[model samples]
Target: MDHFLGIFVVANCYRNGIGVVRSLQNANYWYQKERDKQLVATRELPYNVDNGLKNMLLENKYRLSWIPYNEFKNIEKIGEGGFATVYYAVWDNKYLDADIPAALKIIHRSKKYSEKDYSEQFIKELKAYCDIGYDNPSFLECYGVTMDDVSKEYIIVMRHALEGCLRKNLSSVAMMGWQNKLTLLLCIISDLKTIHSKKYYSSRFT
Candidate 1:
């Protein structure tokens, strides 16, 4: 009787083991299905605000005026220069198929200039940029140009640079070893050579 009871107990343990194995298999299958569903949902979702802005500009053929500046809502002032102040802006890009990320350099109107002078200078600057062409990526990319009807001020739309400027980088180089400084100087000279070549070509032909 003891031998028979021991055999029955072993059989019961084996059945329980089989039940646990089946339960584990079902759980793994459901987990995999849920993971796949999540991935598909993520792909279908709208792009983030920054990407949307970029897509909108690209899809609109880099036309700055078409972009609603108010919608972008300035994040911060990036830089200020002699002629204008640049602000970092973020916006939605629902118009674009790919929904690319974007940034805008908001150019503020010069306070020093009269309305007439502002108009003239704005046109002159626009012409200079247009004539120079966008061949060099180092050169700021101008996307759009517009003048405010009320302020009679010019705004140039440009691609935003998160890494800041060459001037700031140069300051960092000043603290570096002499070898690095020399290398940087050589690079600067190379850039100057390219600029000079472009100027020569422009003068010679057009």
Candidate 2:
């Protein structure tokens, strides 16, 4: 019954067809799976991303939304990357003013990065929203964290950028008048200033 750019929840994702939800809930799951304990033969790996996020939330390091798994429906896989897969979903949660469309960055568990690395990277990106200072108009609003019970992976629920990222809109941007281009430049510059003001710098390409 959700409506987002004409995208409706035809059916709930992570439901029966997904098989992930039920599989995760098997009793004594963690206790039985000392399989993971064996992975940490030497150093203690960072506890799962779920715990890391919860601890950060408690410390008030960054304000993040914690959306329950049940709140999401009609999850549609939209894209994939080396680290995570992106999804479009309808989020209906009590904390939200209203149900809204959201983009879910579901971090993959086993890939190029180990569980610890993925957890760190996941938290890092989410914290960037706060580091850039959410008060600034240019920062993408990070709604909060959602967990995929089946895979035990963390999903970042963020405000969906409908036109895709700025780079994707460049062709149309080129057609705009000088005034519009100038405005866009100012927004980007202003954001950079905000980051620099916080004494943060990045050499990341993007």
Candidate 3:
């Protein structure tokens, strides 16, 4: 766990200070103003990451590798989040004759998000990752997309972080010196500043 994730998980909170996000409204707006706005802002939390990325790949003419589930070997559950489950797997690259370790994020369908809603959300998130990918080394590097055969759910394949999330290693950070903590916070602030400028916001940042 590192301070960088402090922003990684909630970088979108920067949307408020930036004019980048295009706000969408629904009929529910009449009953609840503030709450409805928040709902509209985050109506789709990307538990379903594939459908959106698929469309994006087509629209943008971008090609993201599609690896079948069977190619992932020794899959083991590592962690679970509100919207997705994380797994540790080794990607067997047939052409390269190499095994690549990766983290697979499998999004779970929720009662709150239908296919349309979640698909849009997943696309938004994938776009955000693209924005931060190579240009910003601090973010997770997404390799490709895959699916869980049994669940028919999509998975995001990315570089595995052996250290896990910062929350998992908070104790170590708490023991660090003031200068170090400040430096970490500075990194998070810098990342957040970038997210904000991109006109994206993650309501999960609180």
lDDT of 3 by residue, 1-206 (tens): 23323333333223111233311112112112221121111122234445556565544332345667888999999888788888999888564455767799887767788777766666665667656643443445666667688887777777676556667667878998885676556655766776777776765542
RMSD of each: 22.3, 16.0, 14.1
lDDT by candidate, in order shown: 0.42, 0.58, 0.58
- Give the clashing pairs for model 3: 1-166, 12-201, 12-202, 13-202
Candidate 1 accuracy as TM-score? 0.45
lDDT of 1 by residue, 90-139 (tens): 54433332221234433345568665565566555544443333333233
Where does candidate 1 stray beyond 4 Å?
1-66, 97-114, 146-152, 170-206
Clashes of each: 5, 0, 4
- Using Cα atoms with residue i matched to residue i, what is each candidate's TM-score against the true structure? 0.45, 0.62, 0.60
Superposing every Cα of model 3 onto the true structure, what RMSD results? 14.1
Q: List the residue pairs that clash in candidate 2.
A: none
If the candidates were sorted by their TM-score against the true structure, best first, what order would they fall in?
2, 3, 1
- Our model 2 lands, by Cα RMSD against the true structure, at 16.0
lDDT of 2 by residue, 44-72 (tens): 22345457766766565445656677778
How many backbone collisions does model 1 have? 5
lDDT of 3 at 138: 44
Q: What is candidate 2's local distance difference test score?
A: 0.58
Relative to the unseen true structure, what is the C-alpha lDDT of residue 109 in candidate 1, on a scale of 0 to 100?
55
